[model samples]
Target chain A: MKAVRTIAELREQIGEMKAASAKATIGLVPTMGYLHQGHASLIRAAKVKTDIVVVSIFVNPIQFGPGEDFETYPRDEARDLAAAEAAGADLVFLPSVDTMYPKPTKTKIAVSEVTSGLCGASRPGHFDGVTTVVGKLFHIVQPDYAFFGMKDAQQVAVIEQMVYDLNFNVTIVPCPIIREEDGLALSSRNVYLSPEERTQALVLSRSLRETKEAVKTGQIRTAGEAKELLTQIIGESPLAVIDYVEIANFPELSPLAAETAILEQEESVLMALAVKFGKTRLIDNCLIQPKGE
Target chain B: MKAVRTIAELREQIGEMKAASAKATIGLVPTMGYLHQGHASLIRAAKVKTDIVVVSIFVNPIQFGPGEDFETYPRDEARDLAAAEAAGADLVFLPSVDTMYPKPTKTKIAVSEVTSGLCGASRPGHFDGVTTVVGKLFHIVQPDYAFFGMKDAQQVAVIEQMVYDLNFNVTIVPCPIIREEDGLALSSRNVYLSPEERTQALVLSRSLRETKEAVKTGQIRTAGEAKELLTQIIGESPLAVIDYVEIANFPELSPLAAETAILEQEESVLMALAVKFGKTRLIDNCLIQPKGE
Candidate 1:
């Protein structure tokens, strides 16, 4: 495995690799460092599908809002490098703040509609920063396939929309969300949670799981009912301050009416949540397919 | 020469061409049909520098303002194809409005600072449209070198800034502005001019040339002095109605102070104009290099 910290070096290295094997398919896994099981899962998926797996680790600052955790975002380069290589990344890109952005970026890539709710609403300009940095990574690597985790489900949707709308040549491969044995969604920010808050965080995934089961069993027939049930379940935890409990159509992310029947809708439904346990904000979601004909 | 109207076919054709020659360098000349000597010059430059020359003709609607001439924009497919071939183009992409945009695009690429003034101010969202469509073309063609005419000088600057900021892998080659013997800049919209209006349009280029000569001879010193001379020279034409006469730093497109000495600036300076001949609007510019050490 090789490591690079500059854009020029990464391009040259990718070019040389492609020159040696003209038909080699490249895969990219873009991430902020402090790699956990979630990131490793994405890298492992890329290893199975591509000839060259390049993992880029840069904690882009622009994505964080004014009061967000820009200064305190977790990062561990040494651990991340080892984890990326062990998970089958052929190359790991570790660009510094200065290397990634010598100057502030004036160009922005925005995907509308899909970016209007959920995490986008909770944290403004977050998706713009994600799309812009992802765009830069796409250009720098020119990868054949880019892997993403459904852990950031809204992010996956926004990126897919951007790729489709922009006619980008690369394909987006979305992997499943990784989770702990107790069903708590794996996140680097989980490290920030106090021991008590950590246990309460499991309510997020539990509520989503129960909601999916309720919809499947026809007990929760409408979006409003589901939201009410989720609110009740998450409300049980004292430390879990609910930021948003949204039930919207998948991909398009248009809000569903309160009385809209989830099982009758042709498109898939997304039940997403953003909750704060003290200062750490954690998000999780599930996609529910409509009942088939 | 070959012609393709759909994105899929163009991609397949370019793929086959690249497969045959692994090291072939591709060049792209993006235009809005109605090919003239100016577009031909761009094509010819591409032929000299690249192994495959692909010219795309798309009159992107998003770039036009509410009352702009998008509907009346001139187009001649047969004539354009012939001219493109004659100028050494290997392929021409002629996508229809539906082909280029099957649906309203939700994604937008915006470059700030460089697109804030000059034509950008006169035509709101114009550069955004240009950058978005051009970005789509860059992904679609993945060309090695993209050729552009200096006729739209601010456009060149905006694109260069986007490519730099976004880390697009292609090089932007700015060709000199093509002009007629009478010093009139070549434009597809030239077809809109009446014979008398055409004669009057020559003032656009004439004023630029005189301004360039005056600055070179040290007769024009400050930005305010140059604007005054340009406004007065172009005022001689009875049919010409001034829209804007701006002097700004090149590429940055930031306005120069009224008293700022043009010759002392280290960066190249741009003197740009937009004027209406009856109902037809035309634009032109001249770039002045700083005195060398």
Candidate 2:
């Protein structure tokens, strides 16, 4: 496995790799460092699908809002490199902040409508940062397939929308959300949570699981009912401060009416949540398919 | 020469071309077809530099303002194909409006500061539309070098900024502005001018040429003096209506102070003009370098 820090070096390595094998396909797993099980899952999935698996580790500063964890976000290059190599990444792009952004970026890629809610609403300019960095990665890697985890559900949707709208010559392969045995979605930020707060974060996944079950059992037919169930379950945890409990049509991310029968809709429904446990804000979601498809 | 309409067919053809040649470089010339000398110049330039030269003729409607001539924009596919082929283009991608935009694009690529003045001030959402479409073309063609005519000087700057900020793996090649014997810059919109209006349009280029001569002769020292000279020369035409005659720093497109010494600045000075002859609007510019090395 090889690790590169500069774009020029990465391109040179990629060029050599391509020259070696005419039909080799590249897969990119973009991430912030301090790799968790979720990130490894993406890298491992890339290994299966592509001839060259590149894992990018950079805690993009622009994505964090003014008051957000830009300074304190986790970073462990050694651990991340080892985990990526173990998960079968052929190359690791570990660029410093300056290497990624020599100067402040004046260009921004914005996806509207879908980005107007959920995490986008709570944290402004966040999706713009994600799309811009991801765009840079896409150009730098020029991968055949770019893997993203559904753990950042809204991010996946926004990026997919950008790819579709921009005609980027790459495919977006969304991997499933990786979670702990107790059903808590794996996140690098989970390290930020206190032991007590860690336990409370599980309510996020539990509420989503129960809501999915409720929809399957025909108990929660309407978006309003699902929101209510989610709120009720999450409210039981004292440390869980709900930022948003949203039910939107999947992919399109348009809001469903409160009384709309979500189960009867043709599109898949996304039940998403954002809860603050102390200073750390964590999100999780589930996609519920329509009945009798 | 080959011509393709659908993106899928274009991609397939490009893939085959790449497979056949180990290190084939693609150069793209993006245009709204009415095959003027300017566009032909770009295609011919591409032929010299690249293994594959693709000329994309797209009349992107989104760039036109409400009162602008999007619907009335001239297109001659049969003529354009022949011109492109004659100019040494290997392929011409002539996608229909629907093929380029299946739906109204939700994604937008915006470059701030650089797009805030000049034509950007006159036409709202114009640069956004240009950048978005150009970005799409860059992705669709995946060219190693993308060419743009400096006739739209601000456009070249804006796209360069976008490419720099987004880290697009494409080099922007800004071709010299092609002009007629009378010094009128070539443009597809030249077809919209009436015979008298076309005659009056000579003032746009004439003023820019005179201004360049003035700067060279040490007659014009300040931006204000340059603008005054430009206005004086162009005002000689009775049918000409002055839209904007301004001087600014080149590439950056930042406004130069009226008192700023035109020939003393470290950066290249740009004297740009936009004049209307009856209902037709025309633009032209001249770039002046600083004092001798």
Candidate 3:
């Protein structure tokens, strides 16, 4: 595996590779360094379907807000490169801040409608930053397919909308979310969790699992009841502070009415939660699809 | 020469062509259908530097204001296709509105700073629509070079900024403005003018030519003096009503102070004017560059 840090060099390399093999299928996996098993799973999935795999690692600063964890985000290039190689990434693009943004960038890709609630509400311009950086990476890599883990389901939806709206000639593959043994979704920010906070964080996935179980048993029939049930389960942990608990229509993220019964009225909806254990903010979601559909 | 109306067919053709010759460089010229010599000049320029030239004819309704001339924008597919071929284009993409915008588009490429004044101020959301459609074309065609005329100087500036900020791989070629023998800049919209209105439209380019001559002779030293000269020359035509006549810095479109001397104080500046004769609106501009600097 080869690693490049400049846009020009990476572009030239990609250009040369395409020139050599016109039939080559390139897959791109964009990420911020601090490679967890979730990222590895994305790379492994791309390797299964593509002739070449390229992974980009850059902690995008624009996505981080004024009080967010922009400055203190994790970084370990050597370990990341080795892990990417082990997981079958052919080229690793690790661009410097100056290389990625030589000047103040004024062009922005703004996605509407679907970005209104959930993570978009709390992080403010978070999805804007993600979409912009992802746009740049797409143009740079010019891949045939791009793989993304469903851990950030909203990000996947926003990207899908952008690609469709912009008419990009690439396909977006949303892979399943990878998790720890205890069912906690794997995230790079997991490093920030202390021993006590780590244990408290399990409540996030536990609440999601409980919601899924409740829906399976037909106990939670409406969005309001679902939210109430989640709030009660998460509030049991003294360290867990619920930021938001939403039950909205899948993909569109539209709010489901409290009085509207959804027990077999609809196929399924999305149940998402955001909670804070100290300064680390984490999000988790599950799509409740009808069985055997 | 070949003409394709669907995106899938165009992409497939382009894909096969690229596969046959990886070194082939494709150039794209985007336009709305009524092709005049101005578009011809852009096509000719592209032919000089690329292996294959693709021209896209889209009316782009989103760029037009609520009360603007969108529904009545002149279009002739046969004339456009023949003109594009005669101008040395290899392919012409004439996508229908339904094909181009299959559904409501949610992705937008918003460019700021350069789009704040001039036509942008009068025609709100115009540049946003242009940038979005151009972005879609760029991704679909994946050309090596894209050409634009200096006739719409602000549009060229905004596109250049977008390509740079978004890291598009294609190079943008800014071609010279094409003009009629009477000094009127050739535009598809020029067809709207009656014979008398056409004659009165000469003031648009005459002001730009006079501005160039004044700057050359050091006659107009201040922005106020330049505007006064243009206003006097254009106001002489009873049929002509001056919309905007101002001097500003190049590219950035920053307003220059009225008292600031322009002849020797500044290396270059943009002198632009918009005028309406009868119901037809016209615009023309000239960049004043320091000679032999």
Q: Residue B21 of candidate 3: its Cα lDDT?
A: 82
Kindly report which residue stretches of model 2 are placed more than 4 angstroms away from their true locations once superposed. none
Q: Which pairs clash in the backbone of model 1?
A: none
Give the TM-scores of the predictions, in the order they appear.
0.99, 0.98, 0.97
lDDT per residue as tens, model 1, B1-293: 99999999999999999999989999999999999999999999999999999999989999999998999999789999999999999999998888778888888999988998989988989999999999999999999999999989999999999999899999999999999999999999998999999999999999988988888888878999999999999999999999899999988889999999888899999999999998898999998898612
Better of 2 and 3 by DockQ: 2
Instruction: Show the colliding residue pairs in model 2.
Output: none
Stretches off by above 4 angstroms in model 3 are A263-268, A291-293, B263-267, B291-293
Which is the better candidate, 1 or 3, if ranked by TM-score?
1
DockQ of each: 0.88, 0.92, 0.91
Please list, in the order the candidates appear, how each scores on TM-score for chain B only: 0.98, 0.98, 0.97
Per-residue accuracy of model 2 over B87-177 as CA lDDT, tens digit each: 9999899999999899889999999999988899888899999999999999999999999999899999999999999999999999999
Q: Please write out the lDDT profile of model 1 over residues A161-190, one tens digit for every residue.
A: 899988888999999999999999999999
* By lDDT: ranked, best first: 1, 2, 3
From the highest DockQ down, the ranking of the candidates is 2, 3, 1
